[model samples]
Every structure is written in C-alpha cells, then in structure tokens.
Target: GGLPYVLTAHEGSAAFAADVMGRLTGAPGLCIATLGPGATNLTTGVGNAYLDRSPLLALTCNLPTAQLGRRIQMAIDHHALFRPLTKATLALREGAVASVLAEALQVALSEPLGPVHLDLPEDVALAPATEAVPAPPSGRRLAAAPEPARRRAAELLGAARRPVAVLGSSAMRLRNPGLLQAVIERHRLPFATTTMAKGMISEEHPLSLGCIERARRQVQRELLGGADLVVGLGYDVVEVEYEAWLGKVPLLSIDVDPVDADASVTIAHEVVGDLDASLGWLAQLPPARPEWGADLAARHRERFQRALRPPRAGFVPHHAIDVVRAALPRDGILAFDVGAHTHQIASQWTAHAPRTFLITNGWSSMGFGLPAAIAAKLACPERPVVAIVGDGCFQMTVGEVAVARRLGLSLPIVVLDDGWLSLIQVKQVRRRFGLYGTDLGEQALVDPPAHYFGVPAIGAGSAAELARALTDALVADHPTVIEARVDPGHYLDTVYD
Candidate 1:
C-alpha cells in the first residue's frame, strides 16, 4: 500500500521503470522479467540506465541449465548480451541465489553507481536448494573524499572570491539535497544544475539559477569558465563539457566514485567520498567571504529571471510546459524521458521539492518517461505524476499506457509531437552533418490522439488547446494522455543548433 508500480505491457517499460525508479529513489531500483524476449526487449532501457549511471538492478529469467543448448526457442545468450550494458553481469547459480543477489546489490550500489544484471535460470526460482544463504560481504567500499581531501575542497571553496557549484546526476544520487542548499545559502552561491539534477534543490530556492542547458546561456557559460573555484558537487562528465568549456577554472571535485573524480578538468583538489559525508564535513567549515561572487551572482540571477519567462502564445513548446505546470498539483511528480522534451521540461518546470521529478541524466535515453511515470505513481500513488515524452519516445513504449490502465495507475502523460528527431535535427543543423536515420517526418502524431485504455486522451495543436487538455488530465481520476503537436523548430536552440 505504500508504493505504486507500473507493470508495463512490454520489456522496454520494465527497463524504463528500473531507470526512473533509480533516478528518483536513492536506493537501487529493481526490475524483473521472464525468460527470452522479455529480457531482450529491456535492452534499451537497461543500456540507458547503465550509461546514465543510475543505480539499478535488473533480474531476468533464463532457460534452465538442463535445456541450455537443447535448441529450445527461449534459449539465447542473455548473460553475454547484457554484459556490455551493466558494470557487472552474473548468471545466478541454482544454489547460489543468496550470494548472487547480495553481489548484484553490492555492485549496483558501489562507487559510480550504475546498473547490474543477474540472470536466473528458470529452474532456480522453482527448484529447492539445500545450500545456506551467504551473508552479504562487508568492506565493499563506496567512493568518498578522505578527511584531508575534504579539508582541501573546503579550503578551495572557502577562499575563492568567485566560486560556484555545478550540480549533476551524481549529486542527486548521493541524496544530499540539503547539502547543496546549505552551501549555496551559506556562501550566497548562485548555482546552476544540469537537466538531470533539476530537483536536487527546489528551483524556488533563492540560490537556484535554473535548469542550465550549457550551450545556450552565454552569461552562465562565461561564469562557469571564469569562476576561480568551480565546485563540481557530484557532477558527472556526461552531463557537462567541463573539460572543453570550463577554461582555466580549478575544479574542487566531490563525487561517490574515483572515475567521476578522475574526469574532472583543471582540478585544484579532488575528493572521492560519499557525497553526504563529504558535504557534512564541508558544512562544518566556515563559509568563505562572498567578495568576488556576489556581483556575479546578481548578474546571473537577472539573466535567469529573464529566461524564466514562458512563451505566452502560439504553438510554442515552452508554453506547453507552463500549461502543464499551472494545471498540475504543485506537489505533483514529473518523470521525464531523454530527448528534446526532457530539457524543455526541466528548463520550464519549477521543481519545488525532492523526489518530485525524475530524469535519465547519465544516458539521456529516449523511451524512459512513461515507465518512470508509472513507477512514480506506484511509489507515491496519491500524488499526481506527469510524464513528458517525445512522439518518437511515446511510440517506443506507448503500450505501457495499456499497462497503466489495467493496473489502475493514474498518470497523466504529455507527448511532444515534434514529428522529427528534434535533438538530432538540431545537431545536424549546427554541424552541417548529413542526417541519416534521425528523421521521423512520416511518423503519425495521432491527430485525434490515442487513449490510455479508458483514460481520456487528446491531441493539441495550439497553446490554448494544451492548457485545456492538461487542466482536465491533471484533475482526472484515472490515467490520461495529452499529445501536444509542436513545431520542430521550437526547442533548446543551443544544443539543437
């Protein structure tokens, strides 16, 4: 009764559930599937979660050892296939269930938290084993900054006149929302977050600059390049181009793993420690005077304020996001998939609390939103959960809609129908690269829109239509989907360009 779950109609949804759950919940998220195709169908989601460095555990059933190579149709190389997608992949021995489960969890939760896979033979789940359950091992250390490293990081942040902390997916995973806020408030640091770290600190907080698309904001980019001390708190390399753009700024890197710490550029100091513990140590240190950073913070705040203005009319994408925010519950949960819509939602939505939003930060996978929405609703059924996805993404896992209906999951899904692979199109436009397979022009937008089982559904063409659709969907008692048809040109101009 305490948690809500979405058993999507397909394996892709299962993978998405694992990712979304991993993103929102600090603990490792788990997903299970039957043998054969159920396991293969989850490939994309698993890869996405793995690449994004979400803490996830995926369990898939396999053909019994007795039938391993007897030409059975269900028999295939699941273990080998999943090897590349997970940091560790183990085939569960019939009598070693306890050990396998323990190992899988340990690896998934270890430093640089990422997905782990355990393939169980079908017979193991049904067979009786006489072996003793092994105790989970100790001394499997997670990464954290040592005392000296912590002191160094603190000294850097404490002394720098113009210092700023850039938060990332790892910070969200470390579960130190209050730490960021404390440091920001204490030093009056105006911080920016990558799309994945949207809800780490409530956007309404005074120090929050906004969800930063690194390519577009010139002033924020300049500030990042020029800051004397760039405190990367749990920042991941995949989310930001720090090496290329951060200029000569010295980075005081703090994260859960050595790999993430190693990816830092212009490092004056590195602290690989549990994020919370490191932050706690830093919290004990005196705040550095905000001499050089105060004016810079004010200027960035002004730019941030101007950028917060949502487009008022026409078929603008930002306006659609505003409509959803206005219509939904302020405490509502937003589960976003990776695509053009992901950044737009993060930039536009105001995350007011922790666990209120989810994103595929590490991998930026496309078909994650619907499954995440289901998982969020399952975890917190009473709160409204909104999923923002792309039309291509919707079609990738649209069948999950039926799963939501059958399972009685009440989620409102918003599909951005830009008809083309908007992100790729933008990349193509900017680089003058010949586009190969990224176009989705022939794809259908469901002019009338499709329903989620019995839930109401509509296809919106204008800003007013989206507002009306969202109003009812947000208030509806059951599942609903609003497919907003958008112009392909309306997106984060920087990244796409």
Candidate 2:
C-alpha cells in the first residue's frame, strides 16, 4: 500500500501514464486526483484512453453525498459521460469501497478493456468498512467457451492454404508472443500487427510480417487481400483503415470480449476465451503446410525490402527517422503522436518488440507522443524512450519537457519543426477546406527554444547536426531536446492530401 507517489505537473500526463502502464503490463493502469477541478482536467486523458480501448483506472474525489447535485459545477454526470467510452463507471456509495474496488478491477481487466472511472467522495474514502474487501478471482482466468466455437476456429486455421494472422493491442497485452510465434512457426504463417501492436513479436523473426499501418500500399493490395483466410486475433478493425476491404477476406475472429465483435462482422467463426489457451489448442492440430508458409514469408520480406528506400540524402523525413533509428538501440522504444510526420515515421521506423511503439491510433490525438514517452519511461525505467513529436504538437505539451527533466528521466525528444501544421497545411492545399487555419508564423515557433527545461537544447539544420544531438543525448546523464528543423516540402508525400 505504501507505493511512492509522483506529483505530475498536469492531470493529462498522469492519465497518459496510467494508460501506458496499463497497456504495457497487461494490468489495469491507475490515476488518482483530488476533487472538483482535478476531475474535470483529467477527463480529456480519460476520454482518450477510453476511445483507444486502453485498460485504465481513473480515481477522483468528490464532495460529500450531502452536496450531491447542488449548484456544483464539478458535479457533472461522471457515470453518464463515461458510459460511451467505458465498460463500467461507478460512484462509490457508503461502505462500498472494498466490493466496488473488486468489481471495478474485474471490469477493468476484462476483455475489450477500457478506461474505468471511480468517483470516491472524501468522506467515503476515509470511512473504513468493517468487513474485509473480498478478493477478486484471478483476472487472467478464462471463462469456459462452447466446444462448437473452438472446433470451428480450429477447422478454419487448419484447412486454409494461404492464411495469415493479424495481432492487435489486446494480443500484445496477453503477452503470448511465444505462443503466437509457436503457432506461426508450426503453421508457417506470416504475422502482421496493427499500429498499436508493434513489437508483440521480435521484428528480427523471419516470419514477422511487420505493422499493417506501415506496410506498403502494394503489400496491402497484394498480400493482405490476397490471403484465402485471415485470423484477426484480438484485432479491432475499428482502429485500422481498410476495414471494408478486410470484409472481403474470410475472417476468423478471436476476441475474449463480446464488445469486440463488430455489427458488420465478416467473421466466419468466432472464438473467445483466454487467447493463449485457445491458440495453444489450435496449434496442436495438424501443422499448416510449410510450402504455404514459405510463399507468404518470401512475399512479405520482398515487399518490406521494396517499401524501404535508403532514407533519401540530406534533410528528408526518412532521413530523420533513419537518424533516430540509427542512434537508438535495436530494441529501444519509440512513441509517435498523430501528425503528418507519423505516416512517414510509422512506415520507416522499425519496431522490434511489443509495447516498443506507442501511439493513439483510434483517437489520433495530437500532443500525445511526449506524454506517451514520459509514461513509457516511468513504466520501464531501464529502456531508452524516444518521442518523435511535430512542431505544432511540441508547442502543446512542451511544458512536459520540464516535467521530464524534473522527474530526472533522461528522455530524448526529437521535434520535427516545419513552420506550418503540415498535415492540415496539406489538407488546405488539397482544397478540402476553403479556409486554412493551419498557417502559423514565427510567433508559433517557441522563440529562443534553444534552452529547453534549462538544459541546452540543440537545433539541427542538417543530418550532421541531427547526428550530434542524438549522440549527446545517448551519452548524457541528463535529458536532452534535439530540435531538428525540417523543410515542410520534405514531407510532401504525407503533407499532400
């Protein structure tokens, strides 16, 4: 109970920290705040995690029951507001802490995980219940599944001539990379991941197919749609584009939660349970043909190699990603917030393991990368955490740079400074919007940004300077901010709508 507590400068960072911890550990992440303004400020982060289906716990203090709904601005409907984004929401009643906590934990950890809010009044939190809090059943234990469904999944995985497996965020949390690897090797199947599911298996693995978000359009065209059968293992198509296209492929969906099911479902068979166990059973059936595996594997490697063009010389988007990737340890973690830059980096930066890459795929929220890196470092202090943030987004949460320094985390942040909001600027160029609110002048640039959080931040105009800044951060004991100035034109591939 005596855990060390950190004072975060902002509630959003706290919520993000909880979300990352939850995603990384496969356990519920936790966040707590005082009454009134604290609760309201934390809502944005709560909503972000909820929309992304991240398992999180947000705890907030409320006024006494006597004050319920009485001219209280902060007394907004917490339960109702969260219902759309969460599996369960609760306002702690008198003497209900233990029972409520147990139930909340259960709901929070269950399949189709999402942010769970708990409103505890000050009086209720202090008031002790006479009875012991009932211990919840081990959250990881699987519920029984019908035999027919299991057989169907097995049959689908077994009969296919050219089959592939798509892993999602939930599969990564379940931490069965070995099991996944076993199935892939036994059946000789190519494995692909959604953006959030990066690093679930080692990228170095021959069968590792790479991320769908980054896969070349050609690969998406030829390989993904070409499969005779596709297994969506904890895959949530809602987060990925090309769902309508995926509908055409024969889908065998395996999700533990009913909410994971889609109304426009193309699944011929659905198997929900402890995925590791279900998959383990499926692996026991006759192994998939080696020839089928060899064909897909060769095509996957060929496409990945084709997608990669040596980062263009000079100041290019791919070059920037290459610089960062070169400086990073082969297994170092990376997080990218939504921006025009993300499309390029996601396609370029190679992830080697699960939870190594973090992003808000479903919410596509701006100003999330810095906070995600902060959160990732907090959870795994041993790893090198990098945030590839945009010029526009860097301004939004740049204050957190000071927070990182204060936390004494040696986080290295690379800011891609292009004067305009590149993504929006592209949209404006495409004439999607008559008015371009995306334009910003020198005023938008953090003038004298050289010194970030009192640490001497360096500005890089070319690849050489970029390399020097990265070297300093890798060697320094303190946090370093490397501001790389990139031409907006260099990112035209992404900026052009």
Candidate 3:
C-alpha cells in the first residue's frame, strides 16, 4: 500500500516503463492494468520484456468470479492471452493470493529473467485474506563453474594468441562488473558489446573496441577475423545472431544458460554458471598475452573517432548525438528508438556506465525511447534523462508527452524529423524497390505557437540550433520536444552500404 505508482498515457506502452526499471534496478518491475482491452494493450510491453529478458510483474484486474465463465463484457481469458508472453500466468485465488504473488515474483526474477502475469479477479481481490503473506524468497544463488568446464575454458583461452570478449545483455546482470573487468584487463583482451549491452562496460575504457551495431560491423568483422578465439561472456543469441559468429575461430561461452547450439556457432568450450564466478575463475588463471589486440583496438578507435566527427553541413544525426553527449552529464541516461539514427547513436555514443544508454535492441521496438526515458527518469530522478527518437517513432508514442508533462518531469524528447520512415526507405531503395510507404509528406508542427499536446515544441535545423534547443529543454521545468530537421541521406552510406 505504501508503494508508489506512475500513470502513463497508454496502458500498452507502460511496459516500456517496466522494461527500463527492471533493467536499471535488476528487480521485478510492476505494471498494473484492468482486464480485457487494458490487458491486451499491455501485451506489447509484456512481450518486449519477455524477449528482452527484463524481469516484470504484470498485474491485471479481472472481472468478478461470477462473470468469468460467461460471455459477458470485458471477460476475456487473461491467462490464455498472457501465457505466450510471460514466464508463468496465474489467476489469483481467494486464499492463496500472497503465495501466488510470491511464486510469480520468483519466476520473474529467476535466471534469464522475464515477465510474469497474474490476473487478480475483482472478487478475489476484494475477499479477505486469512493466510499470512510469505516472506520473500532468498536471493538467487549463482552456481559455481564446473571444474572440468573451467579447465577446458582456461586451456582454450591460454592457447589462443588473439582472444576477444563479446559482452551481451546478460552481462548487465552481473553482481560485480569489476570481477568481469578484471578478467578483461588482466588478460588485455579487446572487448566489444552487443547493441543491447552497449553500456555493460564503460566504452571509454582502453580495452573497449566498441558496440557491435550495424554501423561498426566493418571494424568488428576485421577484429573477429584476426581473433583466434571468441570468448562470449553472458552472450545472448537474441542480440546478435549466432550466424554472425560462425567462422574458423571457435567460441568459449560463459553464461547462466547453455549456448544456442542451433545457431551453427562453434563452442569449443563453455562454463555455465554465474558470470561473475566464471570470470573470477578465469581471472585467477595466468594472464594471457598483454598485446593481443592492442593495435587492432587502436585502429578501431581511430575509425570510430572519425565516424563520430561527421560533416556539420546540416543537422547530421551523428553530430547531433555528439552534441547531446557533450551537453548531458557523463552519467545522464539516454534512450534511443529503432531507426537509422539508432545505428549511429548505438555505435558512437560512449556510455560511461551501465544503464546509461538504453535501447530495445533485442526487440528493436519503435516508440520505446520516450516511455523508457520517462521510466529511467523515475528510477534515477537525480540523473537527467533524454530520448532520441525518429519522426516515425515519435508519432507512434507522441501522446506519452502528456504523461511526462503531467508528472512534471524535465525530460527532453529529441525527434530526428526526417519526414519519413528512413530506415525502411533505405532498405527499399537498396533492394531496388521504389519508395512506396516510407514517405511522410511535409506537415509543419513546429511553426510559431506550436505545442505538442501542451508540451513546448521547438525546431532545430542545424547542429548549433539543436544544441541550443537541447540546452533550453534540459533546463526547463517541464518536458519539451525538440524536432530537429535531419537528412536521412547518410543512411545510404553508413547503414545500407
């Protein structure tokens, strides 16, 4: 009863809040809604958590028990509807409410965390509870690495002259990132992160190669070619397909779950247990060569720096991101929506800490950045939060700005207004299919006296103007939307190429 709740403009998009909260807090995020249409609306967010492996508790108030079996108004089967999107779905019974809720929490918090569903029937919810609520379950324990697997992994790593570590979303769950960093540092291993795990390790570190996003695939491919062994730490196939890892070099996987063998990626050795414990074991082994990929990392960094300094002729997305990076505090949080802009941002934006850069890479869902930014702000109110979204994504969740304004959050929504579904348009053009549904004809919303659902709307046409607009928006006491008129032509060279 003492818990706090935040309301959103759309119930379906509320899962984005849970997604960000769960990720940032490493705890089960709570999202509540009424039954039928309300529950249906929550499915996108729930499914997002499911695929992204963000722990969430989805609570939906259902019709009374008497009306459950009948074909009455708003009485859809919540269990059946949520079954596919959750780790488990249970309807709250009168006497076992506390136990059911506890069990749901456990399932959601277990390894490879995901969303769980509980349909609280109105009658059951109103009924008196005689049973006492059980104590919360003990913290999850990490299984120690097996001796034989540890030996195999150590031998493989020791024999390799060039080893590179690939960090993925699961790495974010590590209880101690320092232990993993020690392993990388002690071995001088050149490392890169998956798109979803871009900030798992600080990108500013000397060993950081960069994120494995589409924009940096060329550099990553070159580095992977020279790698004698690929050490995957907390790697998940959902972020980057196994096919991308298939090659002559064998992989050494360390994760809570077994490798996805069907991906055709070779796993020479594996240590399945807590990632921290696995890394702890690896850290104790004799350090590998100190200069395995130092030259490669330097080359990668050189190329990356050049990419970050894009032409400033007009409002370039990369330059805009660079400006945003300089403006926001080093620890401030940034959320990105799926689009051409995301490729550059995810690749070039150097995250100082985990959870600083949030994106739905696994789900690659649109309309996630704005809502996720709101959730990030609520979770860490001290740090500034901003959403970098595409014009198409902004339209999908523009209504959420009202929710942000109502909460009096000083969040800024920076929309890259290119007047089209730029990513799709690029793909269509590359595939020799003329533009069909990608264009969004000119519709001026940033004219004088412009307001986006009561939130101030500012326009920025150049890097300098975008910086000024962002500065004003960040200092404002309320949410503001900066519509930056950007050119999508860069996608032809950076992404579609």
Question: What 10-residue stretch in candidate 2 is worst by lDDT?
Answer: 488-497
Candidate 1 least-lDDT 10 residues: 488-497
List the RMSD of every prediction in angstroms.
3.3, 3.1, 1.8
lDDT at position 163, candidate 3: 89
Q: State the displacement of the C-alpha of residue 25, model 2, in Å, after optimal TM-score superposition.
A: 3.0
| Ordered list by TM-score, greatest first | 3, 2, 1
Give the number of colliding residue pairs in candidate 2. 3
Candidate 2 wrong stretches, greater than 4 Å: 125-137, 257-266, 290-299, 305-313, 428-435, 442-448, 488-497
Residues 1-497, candidate 1, lDDT per residue (tens digit)?
A: 54445466888778878776766655677778877788888787888878787678888888877777566887778878899999899888877888877888878877667788888887887888777867744324555566777777777787888777888777776555788778677777778787777777877766676766533455456667766887777777787566655767787777765534335466787788678878777766787776654355556666754564434445766767778788777689888777766656766677877678777766666777888888888767778888888878887887888877887766778888877777777777678888867877645634743555566678888878888777777667678888888765655453432
lDDT of 3 by residue, 112-220 (tens): 7899999898999888878997987633666888899999888888888888898888887777877768888888889988888877778878888887756746766
lDDT by residue (tens digit), candidate 2, 1-497:
86557667678777877788888776777888776778767776777788677788888888787886677866766666667766788888886777888888888776666788898876887786776858653454576457788888777777787788887766765646677677777777787777777677776677767666542434554677778888877676566744544657778877665434345646677787777777777668788653454556657766665565434455766667789988888678897778878766665567876678888777777878888888888888888888889878888888888888888887788988777787777666677566467765643454345687676687887878888888878666667888887766645443321
Candidate 3, overall lDDT?
0.83
Question: Candidate 2 deviates by what RMSD?
Answer: 3.1
TM for every model, in the order presented, reads 0.89, 0.89, 0.96
| lDDT head-to-head 1 vs 3, winner | 3
Selected candidate, larger TM-score, 2 vs 3: 3
Error of 1 at 106 (Å): 3.1
Best by lDDT: 3
